[model samples]
Target: MDRVDRIRERKREHLELALTEASQSRRASGWDDVALVPSALPERSLGDIDLSAELVGHRLRAPLLIVGMTGGHPDARMINKVLGAVAEAHGIAVGVGSQRAALEVPELAPTFASVRDHARTVPVLANIGALQLIAQGERPALGAEKVARLVDMVRADAIAVHLNVVQELLQPEGDRVTGPLLPALAALVRVAPVPVIVKETGAGIDRESARRLVDAGAAALDVGGVGGTSFARIETERAGVGEGPFADWGIPAAASVLECRGLGVPVIATGGIADGATAAKPLALGASLVGIGRAALLAANDGVEAAILTVGRLIDELRTAVLLSGGARPSDLMARPPVLTGATEAWARQRGLLA
Candidate 1:
């Protein structure tokens, strides 16, 4: 099959695999170890709590971002439309899956562009893979210019350069590279019209890598940590390779949030964030936003109205968590602080991320 055909097939497979009974099975997100301190006297009414937040100049009604999942297929048009409409109604941001396939095939552009068509106001992030950018090779400036066009294709508020080395290694068709990724990312950040966000695919970003990406000019970070969707397991299954120990690889989302804290940039805590309480823990760990992936995808599978209601329920849960924690606003939840324990605390200490 041709590149475009491969991209299209991959999208279909991803969607099919994502909605599987096995895919919906729970995985560890590591948030369980981070305990939010409860207030005996919250001193505030739940109705007064504000979930509003601002990121890269866009004001969100809530700090929840519907993370990128799929695109590059005909079915993606309906999915993006549903997700975009839900985001617009909820006043939150939504991201499209990697635009590489669409970029490779002009005819497929509409699959990703449909997002901008539906989400007229909220932040819409365009995605590209880091390895793909590096593979363009020798003409860094040219690659950056092409990425800029991708942003324009969707009128994206920000562009997310996703890092998925583990996923790539696991995939039979994956590319393995030993060279540096920062220089290429830096080149893209310099010329892209919108802010560039460096995100992990599933295996989370460590403090060292996070620092380097920030230095390379990333405007934000999405620590797509482990304990959520294990791409290793997914790809292995898709490849018919059966199960392996690599399925549980990478840092957990909670530990990743702690590692990336105090880095002077906004952190989006994702991976295994299913409900409001789980989402609230990331804020206390210094994440500016929380991301939901599988949960949102499952809801979207049920239809647009189902997706909206699902997201609404999560927001309601987050608000209740804030009130119970003595926070009158989403921002206040950050100040409440969480007690870190178990593997999460040990991971932080071992990495020198904690005092």
Candidate 2:
């Protein structure tokens, strides 16, 4: 098979392996012991709790959006359709994976087009790997704008410029990602003609990087932090690349949020977030929204209703946690302090971020 065929095959394998083996041991994204303390006799009304939130120029019924995964392939459209339908129904946002394949074959538009048509009336986000901003030269630059405009094409709300060097290094036919990424990113933000969000796949973002992205004109930051999908681990196993004794890699979700605190850009916490408390921790530590992927994928495989049912359950858990923390709404969680400890603390201290 050629490079293009290999990418498509890898997507299939990723779904199967991620669904099965990725669940083997609950790889700790280092949430072993950090938590937000519950408020005792707090002056807050749970009855008045609000789940409504706004981000990336769109309003959401909930604060979560299933982050980008795969969409340039035929196999992925069905999944996107199911995910999109549920996202719309629930009033959350949906982000399609890299659209490079569709760029390769305009015939593939239907695959991603299904996302806009299938979901409930919710915000959808177009996704493209950041490297694409320059790889295909002027066409890609123009394509980026066309992609940004595709929100209208698919009725999307925004777009995510995803950075995934780790995944590329591991993929068999991944392109040679070169050049200074920030300038290209800044240019995209300046001219994309849509709200652009800069996101990391799973490695986490520090305060400095967050600040830089904000300066680069990112509307928000989705710190798809470590402790969730270890793309390094995933790719190493799949494409058989990257050999550096990664007994482990990635900064945990907790540390990522802490480092990004007060950076102006809202941090979307993802990576190993599983439960109500885990969801609450990042918001408490300074994340704008919490992203759940693999867990959602597992739930989604059962069908759209099953998927939304699972997502609803998670939302309920997050709401309950928010209320008990004395937070009147999702935004209030951002004010409560999270007590970071253990490895996550060490990470904060190393960066002089722990306070």
Model 1 Cα lDDT, one tens digit per residue, 14-92: 8888767444324566798999998988988878999999778999999988888878898888888888989998999
**Measured by TM-score, how close is model 2 to the native structure?**
0.90
**Colliding pairs, model 1:** 28-227
Lowest summed lDDT across 10 adjacent residues in model 2 is found at 21-30
TM-scores across all candidates? 0.95, 0.90
lDDT of model 2 at residue 282?
A: 74
lDDT of each: 0.85, 0.74
lDDT of 2 by residue, 1-355 (tens): 8756765777777776667654222345656657778888667665677887777767888788888776656777778888887787778888887767666666667777888888647777887788777754334453545665455556667778888876676666565655578888888877776788888888777777788889989988888777777666676776555444552455667777787768776778888776766787777776778787787677767888888888888888888888888878877875766777788888788889866
Q: What's model 2's overall lDDT?
A: 0.74
Q: List the residue pairs that clash in candidate 2.
A: 29-227, 84-119, 85-119, 88-120, 89-120, 228-272
